[model samples]
Target: MRFYLQACLLTTLLGLYLCISEDSTNQDEKLPTIGVSVLIRNKAHSLPYFFTYLVNLSYPKDRMYIWIHSDFNEDNSIEIIEAWAEEYKSQYNGMYITTNNSSGPLHSGEQHYVKWIPEHFNHVIKLRQQALDFARKQWADYLFMVDADVFLTNPDTLELLLGKKLTVVAPMLLSDGLYSNFWCGMTENYYYLRTDEYKPIREREKTGCFAVPMVHTAVLINLKRTVTDKLTYTHTNLQSYDGPVDDIIIFALSAKWNGVELYVCNDYVYGYVQVPMEENDGIQSDVEQLVNVKLEAISKGTPLFWDPFFSKFVDYPPPSKYGLDEIYMINLARRTTRRELMEQSFKELAMDVKLVEGVDGRTLDFTNLGALGVTLMPNYEDPYHKRPMKTGEIGCFLSHYYIWQEVVEKGYQRVLVLEDDIHFTPYFRIKILLLLSELEDLDWELVYIGRKIMTDDEEMVSRYTSRPGYTYWTLGYILNQSGAQKLINAKPLEKMLPVDEFLPIMFNEHPNDTWKSYFPNRDLKALSAAPLLVHPTHYTGQEGYVSDTEDSIVLDGSAFVDGRIVIDHATSRIIGRINSEL
Candidate 1:
């Protein structure tokens, strides 16, 4: 009986130990290895932004194996890639670089970077095959192929693709127009056919993982769901090769033949693909001119989107280097949090600031315009918004008005006006310095450091800046003495309007034909920095962000449709999405 009891006790102990061991194994499991393959041809202009996003991917750097091929080069694109690879070479598990493409290199300026030549196309396919084979040999669990022009804002792009568990997938990339990375249907001629679902999915009106005919630019191939050996990007796997000689199309055909499903996920805004522009400067505008990475999360105004999550505000010198008289931030008394955030940002950057106390419209008596030297049309509704201005809007306008009044009263040469919720770009100080240098000789009253491009006519004034045609957002700007005097002389206090809308009217750029008649002497020479130096700290749906004029709702970002601009509601993109995933 004693021996039997001992045996039973030992068995129970052994069972508990096994359970604990299994739990430990599960907890310490290694993440899957990812193989990143890239094909570049004279896209060095966009490399800096691409590298910025690539280095910060959420996945472990050691877990990612990189293979870069610049088959046909014309400029220093190969050199740029080599430079980045040299810096980050050790961080990755493995690195492969090849500039040998039998297709031959193009001269300084030959075919457009995006060419359809058979030889070039064939070489692309061959290189893709080589990359895939290389990934397979490395025992990679997944393969990521990103073109040089693709900019991934979301660091978890790889993880997100993996979660879908699809054979092949890509995050839909947006452009200035309706261009994206996926095609809904392929025609008989094997060209892209726009279907009804294409626009809706691309616009995120219908958000989900959608099965599509083609996916490229930035796509992930899940080896777990696919047969590694059966895949080919060339015509070998295709039943018929009547399609265009483009490698992406051929790969799509091969994918279809190999029983692989291609999908594009639009559930979230990941990043964007740089569409081919008419002028081929062979350098990325963002790198050459400090252009903002064009995106579409907050407003549907311009391709240039504000990415505060990765904005990575660096502790650089202040705009004082840009020759501004004084830096002032307008903050509402109730918004202590915004003030704190802005204060911290400025403090970290080590900049002096003068806080402009915001006036509460709720307490103001607009009954007498003479006393305030401001005229507000009685019961005046916004012409475009088609609604009476909110009390908050009144407060916002007055806050800005009081600042301009200060600018004129003090006779400041150049004063930077910033809203309390302003978010700085990573290279704000340097970019501003570079931009102001270009504008020093130009004639201008108001120089906008940041704004929303409401129209398409953003004509380039200098290499680094543009003439903003009907822009919005008074979030950041440098008001000169002339600008301040013009605002006061325009009798803006008599006809009250949102500061943003009023600025456009004052600049003679408002698209609305009706508002021009209301304010006739409207020609305040204004210019905007191309990439925009600042944006709101919180995007439309972000938790702490508040817009008095645009959106009064404290939550639900989708409701923030500023003048028919439809956009997705972001729930703190990185953290919120991860929580939901968990």
Candidate 2:
């Protein structure tokens, strides 16, 4: 069995290791078939979320089978399952459901629930054993037992677990509080024991797959393991051992008795499980509680993106820029075409934008630059043959400088600056909103949404960052007042470089050490996103590609006709033809 463990190279590694994951991910091969077994009681409200995430798994559906056992549900859980199965049953390799009609599930706060604990455990154990037997009967390579309330946002979760090749393992799932799926230790009497290693692993201070005594909620059983056949969910299987009536506890005990070590991988965020709210918790409804849990997850830097199906219940991108204060677009006066394209794009998304008139380098001379307090620094070297700074470079620098001046003038706290030549990612508005939630409390200044990295070794400061690394681009970034003021006070005009060139220098990422000495503070706090959300709409050699700075080229020269920017029918026809090919 090829474990294929290489694909999960930790994201904390440099870009060199990233290449390994990239290469492994592109392989064309079928993954091992696995069975997903789930038990549903009175979890009607949570079923849709679980099914949505299940269907959205990156694993090949045809290679995955599902076994669902429903019983003791009072909230139309059986009806919901039938409806879903009717639509999606054929998609999986096989899907089976066993129904047990019995009394309704009792909430934790109910007076009789404590008295019925043993009965509840009996039903759970029977269902779990049935699931295990069903997987083995179908010759499944593995079985993933997940509770209805366990929310998994990561699509690659199944594959990540399979990569470990451990006997029995579970991905660490977070609850609203510090609670997780895995326990580091158990007491002599087979109860909870808070071990010294629990906190570090739970908080992810120490990462990687760690051997743990027990894991529950959502666990993966390696059916291929030789000793797995001896594992049992029924606690009575072991006569001498006396543990609680919990199915999971018994399963753990059974696995331990058979010399199967359980492990939990906390290498990254998968998703979370709902921590049931008490009656006096003031939660209005189950849906409201789910929303609260999701919001908390977002604020804590755990990415909780869901499939587009969930968007039907909630708005994807906010109607307004929820996290940003303002958005500014820098456009040259002569480059009216790019500005028009940008306006059209933003209009489609209903985004509010302010157009800042850019300084036209074509219309500038040496005296005009000096008048504007612009001068090249002593040690500035353009990698391209150490070429002299062009008037276009000066204009580009001054354009951003003026925007920084505006950021400082209005005291805008969170500002997004955009260049006219860039195109937004398909879900730019939605992704930016989600990304901003992660940065809400971070002491950030400039974060690039689009950039060209100069260094091979980039540090991901957060889930989406490459800080303290040299990158080249001024396409799109979020800026703050302090950073704006710092850039203004840096005397950039006194020693000018291209806006793209200066950002790396200010962030202390300039490859050349000489540029760093001149501006030793290097404290602008700039970083960039990985797999940048924005990209240039046009690049060199593309038909419509044009650069105002270099080559003095203009792709679209036609000005307004009948109060509308117009392109010649011939060019339009050619563009239409080109787009059709795409």
Candidate 3:
């Protein structure tokens, strides 16, 4: 049984010792146990995403205990924790939930004794101390400090951490980007605090922590004798603050103080959400075929970097003009064309209910100038071939770019870009209208017009952009004017990833932009709140995919087109090539 542990080269001495000790241990002894502590507030917003982790944890349920520490007495936070505890207990019988009242935002490190509304810095430090105390009292071997918003993309995250010597803060990598706040949540103070004479690191790629950049919700810490002895926690550098007191800085300072080797887990498994990946295959369409191809390639040790841009949801080089959203849509179309199955899939996607123009053939019910914005499905020259060219999705990009240039000329600040084949929850439109109304005051840049698996309650921050939790699916997001400007003024479409994944990546990746998630793109909200979008599952009584074919389609002698069409009952396409034979 080979297990991989993550660490920086600074711990070479300790690493050798640990290896020798592990080798000497008898196989009869039970494997070291890893305990996880999660601190959550405002359960309504963050719990759903937490639940996804609870149900999908990668380690053995019996070997792990999840301690939920929250400040929820006055507000409904405790009740939400209690409810989730019951569910977790029902599933993972060994899991436990604990509640504590926080002194509300600790403003400074002083005032250690608990008081209601303690300084934000004090509150977090105290909470961490409390969690550590609980773990010590319980006699757990290792403690995993996690946040409610953090989830494991790879279910075997624990397996990866087992037997590791104090795995410092690490972030998970996804097709979208790194899955940790360490990258995206950095403020001016954050960089300054991390370094001695802090000079703002402007590089977008220098996201992951230098010497464990972040102690985000998901960190594996060891309760080893070496660590337990030298650790004397203090709060002197951080002054009056209202929010998270840069725990990563504290960890770094402590590591410097003690001889403890601060291992920076640089693996993708321990990365934060902001550090963008080359591309993610998980969120791509034709998943089965894609997965099979990747798996086969991996088995054969192939580089599997062919058409690297296609794997990205956003093109690498963003469009360099105003209102180039159309080019992005076309880029997505070209990528989807790679999979032969996407052609009919999108046509099937069109069967969902749409607000059609009655007789004018021009306007629809979606035109709400007051509270909500509306998207008018423009008819392209060839319609199906919304673009003009074919092989490898060339003209589609130009066609969409032209469309965006026209729309921008019409004075639309922010518009929803939906790739006609996108499926939605039944109430997607209604909910979007309400979201639009709510976001009238918000400074957002984009609004997704699709369906996705949403997690978390309401108050979610730390999005890849200043906006968090709105990653992966681009089905529905609301962009404000500034964000709109950013998109329209971006670089070439080829410079970035796909649009759905690109906006959040750019927002978070940008050295200056401050974006956060106002709302998560989960299904419950999309359906219950009358969002007004539906998939074939709601209309044609079919799931999203039905066929297992490997061919494209041709419509009216053209291959590239916009608007959804179904090949069978389940699959659909956004913009794809036509099968010459069909």
Candidate 4:
């Protein structure tokens, strides 16, 4: 009887162990249902790539559901998605595609334009919410929101993200150079806070994941754990140092309020797809498109010649024996503060500089101004109160003229003329020499180191080639004796416009014969180093310098055409275009 009782106990223990083992096996085999929610507003071109990666995810398609929300009928994105859904619905748990009428105009003008600000921000927020709402209703175990522009190059991206078991996480999506989809910190007032850790995070040699204040482009949420907690993509009243906040910031703030931490993973690579140049919406110029392509190539670990004008890389050439006779810096005498800044800039460039005392426009006699044929147009308008060239403007013009006189009188072959507010890039000297070598055969009147091409003239020569065009500003340039002699002989005093404005007239044939006869269009050759070798010191804000040019301006209501300067805070929030690794 004792042996029989022991045998029954052993049988019961074995049965219990088998039951536990079967249950564990079932749990290991069960796959979580994942819903991919994508909103396609204007990304029809990206559909082919997006669908290719989506269909190829390492995660089981039988357990995955894809929901595409599109509003654009023109791109045929809806048709493509519908066909994909029809073909794949049987393979997956569910496939859904929905189209909602877009809320705003079909094509809002250039995104960078000031007109489409908060309106653009609100439109995007609404679309994201629509996607989120649709995904939430499907009872997905996990919901992933991806921009059409993001191409998931990793096959196991979904599986890898699921392993983290985090409430919210995103893969690192980068553009061009150091720009990425995540900001490391936030300021007290909620602006993009730049911390010292930014470089370390961006330049990490090994793969790792790190916490970030905000995440965008591609993100995953554990819907069962996080989304059910009533999180939302809503607009808030948060204000940054610049203007009103957008949905991304609002989402970040909301998540933080709910005690949810956002993380970005850089353990694997993903491609931020770039728009093709031919399909570009005419917002970016051809030159910009070429630069974007070059930058995109560099970001993908490809080696190429680093054009300092357009790239952050600095490849210095050996110091050139070619040297200018003298470097003249035009600065106001009373501005001892500005003079010091110029001195520091010259020292950094290893250049010997002479300071040309600027003529104070305010102190100039206005009674004889008409003799110089200076006339303010009756209909002239200054948007930034930049017109009606102040006494400072006259003084600045005369300073360049004085330098021109010195160049001609001293028989200097070439002189470097720089503004007091000039700032140089690291490879400035090398770039200048390289540019000179390229144009050695051609005689150039002026070579602009830094200038703003205000007009959209497609006929302009390729950058670095001696081109005839309308360019603005004179921050840094090289003028030869012949150019100086032409300026002195032209007697520019006859029609004393701002020096910058007069330059184009001097270079081109003017309609007015009085000016045309004296300043006949000579080979006033000018070229710019693309990406520009110099910028205003104020832009860099080095040496505790403030702009002496615009510091004293007081714009009254009367100055504006509409009696008020319109502020569109949304313009600041627009994300730049993505450059693809391909």
Which structure among the candidates has the greatest lDDT? 2
Residues 145-232, model 3: lDDT tens digits: 7765443545666666553445354443322211234332335454533433112222223333345334444566677565553342
Task: Report the number of backbone clashes for model 4.
Answer: 2
Ranking by lDDT: 2, 1, 4, 3
TM-score of each model, paired residue for residue = 0.60, 0.49, 0.43, 0.47
On the 0 to 100 scale, the lDDT of residue 227 in model 1 is 65
Encode model 2's per-residue lDDT on 1-582: one tens digit a residue: 234444445433557677888889988766789999998866666677788888878999999988898866556778777767877899999989877666555634444432445557777788899899989999999999998878888889999999888989999987645678888889998888988899988778889999888898899998987799999888767878777888878998998888999999999788788765554433224544455455444434343454454444334223355557888889998777777767655653457888999878676554344456655665454677455455577677888888898888988998989898886654455577767887775777888998876777776877766574777778899898989988887887876667887888887878777666767678888767665878877667875677777753222222212111122454432110112223
* Residue 571, candidate 1: alpha-carbon lDDT: 40
Q: Pairs clashing in candidate 4?
A: 274-580, 361-391
Instruction: Provide the clash count, candidate 3.
Output: 118
lDDT for each residue of candidate 4 in 115-156, tens digit (9 for 90 to 100) = 346656677687677677777787778888887766676779
lDDT of each: 0.71, 0.74, 0.40, 0.63
Q: Quote the lDDT for 222 in model 2.
A: 88
- Tens digit of per-residue lDDT, candidate 1, span 506-581: 9888877676667788989998888888876567786665675565321112222221111132542211011121
Q: List clashing residue pairs in candidate 1.
A: 45-284, 294-303, 295-303, 295-305, 374-493, 374-494, 375-493, 375-494, 375-495, 376-494
Clashes of each: 10, 0, 118, 2
